[model samples]
Target: MEENIDIEQLRIPEALTGPEAADFLRVVEISRLVRMHTWGNDELAYTAGELLAQCHDPYEWNVMLIARVNGVIEGCAGIAMPLDDNTELAHVTLDVLPQAEGRGMGRKLLEAAEQFVRGENRKSVLVETNHAASALAAAANEAEQIHPTSGTGYLPLSSREARFAFSAGYELERVERFSSCAIPLDEALIAQNMEATHAPHRSKYRVHQWLDACPDRWAGDIARLEQCLDRGQSPGHGDWDIAKLREAEEFSALTGRRTIVTAAECVADDALIGFTSISILNHRQDVAFQDETFVELEHKGKGVGLRIKEANMTKVMREFPEVRTIYTWNAPGNSQLLEVNAQLGFISAGITAQWRKDFNAY
Candidate 1:
């Protein structure tokens, strides 16, 4: 018998506990299951609380479409569009239960999401696939390879997600190395890294550390650094300012997460030269994500990146001792940052390929 699958857009309630909470929670559970099945672990799964915050976040618009088989939830697709910037791009994530494959549930949800984004007049859709590092080389010789437009990295064409995106008219955009480092790192290792990267010229710069909220004095400079990072990701995009920074920090706190930030400042003029940050789930401290590390172009080769990253790691140990692992993503072409991460004990765990479908081109 062909199963009957019904898809509907989920209404995110103001409070988590309501008539709609059950479906929302099921979607969160499905996300956990999908990550576990895909990566052999659920480290990247978001908690229900976190999902609620994301839905309520003011700077971004998010919607979830759920697929139910005979009144039971089985799959979901999420579309996230940035209201602050990248307004023309929608990020889509689709997940279906292991037993529900090949029954058209994923396809239905994806189609629905595509229709919704198109209705909103989005210019492009972005999707990502994660592959285990150990298995990549095994099929490198046997399977076809797909390289991103950057031409710097490749993913096996045999991967299911890659094939799905390719068939759907998406093009490979970039490949990023996913890495993790065991934390509560040896104090000696941290000390050694700090000393090795230290320079006399570095004495002109001082490191500052803070929690979730930015100090009013450095707000403007921090916004500038954030804009720098944003421009690096998407050129010709604008509107990253102090207001957006506050909105982001407020959303992070509302998501039951805490952020630890380390920033470098020039002593001569008191300008921020660079900054780095790590975000941890307050309820689940075993793992965290290394958010952003950016340094001004003029200060790139002065060991600013390493100094901020190392100082941030030391703070992570002092503040969140339960953080056993810290994970980060880097472009394959960014050898300098990768080398800094390597020195900090990070190792490649997997690779994630970013795909994009430009509606006008397609």
Candidate 2:
């Protein structure tokens, strides 16, 4: 009976129960191995702990589905809803056991995820894969044609799995570079010159850490940040929104991790003028991800961006001693941010390219 098992015989579990989580971990490990075998890249493989941390959070609007046959897990798939603003799109991320390859189980699991998205009235789906999983990528491409939406894949700046995304009908959209830099925390504090440098005209803002209870304030700031994302950069496959930001914040709080958010505001006007954030991941306990840094256009060109980044880095060094390295990604053309990071001592480490494809074109 096991030998004759068909895709229909495979059970697709809706929720990631405890046992299912363990099984999913095993499946992920196997999938990672297959990825390495195909592309000779170990970075494509994710540890079981990392997978759990990403999918088990309640604040994350992630739908995890597992394919099982006769009680043995064989595959896993998940879709993360956009966190800050664009909830209409569901990002597809999936994996399957090596033995299950060439079978139709991957397609079935993908169909299930698509159905879930349609039920939620989502407009599109997005995914990133590596070359080792060409079969899986092919399945996704076929599904994209049936669904008709924008799908994208990218060469991960630091992973081998990105090659698979290239074969799955995803085109190169943009190139992004990842780099790390160390800040000299022990340096003597420069005298705070209220008027000594290229400071903004109206200055009344202070840097603050986001707390669990400040949902309303955080949500408002996230909304403003979303606007900044839209204005500062062109819209990508997935966009940001307030709901997504709330979900991300809730997830971080539940996991006991800290997301350092610094904002520059007008003191007399009491308006949020600029913002930036660094998410500390537990997987790489010694590293912090400098994410989603943005300043309003009106607030740019002044020294607010540098001031906020410097203040935030100083606070991070003092508060999180375990974090020895900070990593961030910037679009290839973003010279402005590059200058700020360079001044802070960040150096180039690697590059990742964004790839996208419109299903309608295919």
lDDT per residue, candidate 1, 6-106, as tens digits?
A: 99998777777867688888899999999898778888898887787788777679998999999899999999998866789999999899888888887
Q: How many clashing residue pairs are found in candidate 1?
A: 0
lDDT (tens digit, per residue) of candidate 2 on 210-268:
53333565567667666668765747413456766666567776766677777777676
TM-score of each: 0.92, 0.62
Error of 1 at 212 (Å): 1.5
> What TM-score does structure 1 among the candidates reach?
0.92
Residue 283 lDDT in model 2? 56
Clashing pairs in 1: none
Compute the lDDT of residue 67 as modeled in candidate 2.
73
Q: Give the C-alpha miss distance for residue 323 in model 1, angstroms.
A: 1.4
Best by TM-score: 1
